[model samples]
Target: MGTAILSGIISSQGSGSGTQEIDLLPTRFIACVRRPESEDAIRSKLPREAPDSTVSVYVKDNCAAAREADVILLACQPHLYKPLLLESGICTALKGKPIISVLAGVTSNEITHQLCQTAKTESKGVYDTDAFSVIRAMPNIASAVQASSTVLEIHPRPQLKGVIATAHAIFSCVGTVFTTKPGNFAACTTLNGSTPAFFAMVIDGLVDGAVALGLSHTEATQMAAATMRGTADLIMSGKSTLDLRYEVACPGGATIQGLQVLEEARTRAVWMRAMAAATSGQSSLKEGLKMSRGGF
Candidate 1:
């Protein structure tokens, strides 16, 4: 999912700017590593607008890619982060480069510590862990459409300023970016990372409601989605939900009547509970990762 979204952004940018876009980044080659059999499938899914030269796919050969790229994005499954960081030659290749992990259930500290351990083991006395950085980001599947609400977490290491700026630039191309502190990272994940799925559930409910009112499924779904998009746009444009509600309610109107039903059902409280559970689940996930990594 991350690969497809990133490829879409890179590819679309490539087409829009052509060779001129090469100036946007210091390095132009993007290595997308995957399992041997998955290489072809992943490549086939790349956007047609993507130029062949911008991204190269490698099969089971991540070290080579890391060595060639200045900045690396680790979008692999969360469970694979430690092993991959400790892979022979991978730490050496990744030494001094910025690594951005989109892997859930894994913390930046975990990834950074593993990398530091690998570097110390490989280079012995010459290792400088401060030279490298690890950043954790949570971007939803909406990134595929360049409209994700992404949240990023990073330590206040002075050395990582450039890396953070680079990350901001890359993600800004895809969607809005929010920098989150460590304490709030989990909460941000529940809101920014997981809320899209929650919104989808609401959309489904709205669509079902319309269908029950005699609208065809196709028309109902479209209208629900459009309404959602427009409502979000209006909210984004500085219109408060309260103001919008009053605007549509018109005192004793159907909108207000329907809102009363929603209020009676405690829909807002239900969503609040859902997000609270999800945020707690993220803490559990972090604990599980710590246990798996022997309390790293």
Candidate 2:
């Protein structure tokens, strides 16, 4: 996720200053990993051969790294978070730090309670200081290329203004960012996060249709992709999708003829039904607050 965000930032901002600009920035990053091999793999992908930024990559356990960090990011699998934070000494280290958990289905309230319990057991103060913040974010695969549409829900904190700004700046480098309520976070996931898969399926269908009509697989795919790209550009050029469809359906033209067949088959309805099924399943999981250890 971090690498994805970095790539987005680099793509949008153009690689120039190396790490000088990052170091001069107010925010500092410390990545905590469980294994040395993981750290080495992460290091091998740095923007520059050896960038000079305050972003330290620690190969120690979570507990050790959580001690000195002000804002801790939890990127482990959802199922592992509860047990890891409880069993690892890391919970004790996060005495008054803000936590940004990326685990889906795990609520901010749950995270707050778990950390608070750990703090109490360790004789530390309650995890309710002005600096003690928690936020939940949903970022899709595009984050790797810095072209993701990231959604964030931050728990209210007095000292979080700067942090929020920093987060926005960082995420904006990758793509777009939207602030939303935690309750709606899952909806955003279904809309923007899952839409890529939906689009891919649509493209696949189009390509298959072209191949069935005697076009080579590669040629069909390229043509379908370019057509979709052009269509998207047209829609983005200030026209409603429906309006654009009508514009393309020139009076009694081939486009209109094909559209009529699609309409007769209730193609639009079929698409809607598919989306409804996906949205319903997502809504059920979110309403139940069930945490699963799986990728989105």
- TM-scores of the models, in the order given: 0.88, 0.75
lDDT per residue (tens digit) for residues 34-140 in model 1: 55766666667667766677667777788988998888888765655767887889887887888777766677877877887887788774456675688878777
lDDT of 2 by residue, 50-124 (tens): 354645777756666688776666776555666666765665676556566666666777777777676667665
Report every candidate's CA lDDT: 0.73, 0.65
The CA root-mean-square deviation of candidate 1, after full C-alpha superposition on the true structure, stands at 4.1
Maximum-TM-score candidate:
1
Residue 44 in model 2: lDDT? 60
TM-score result, candidate 1: 0.88
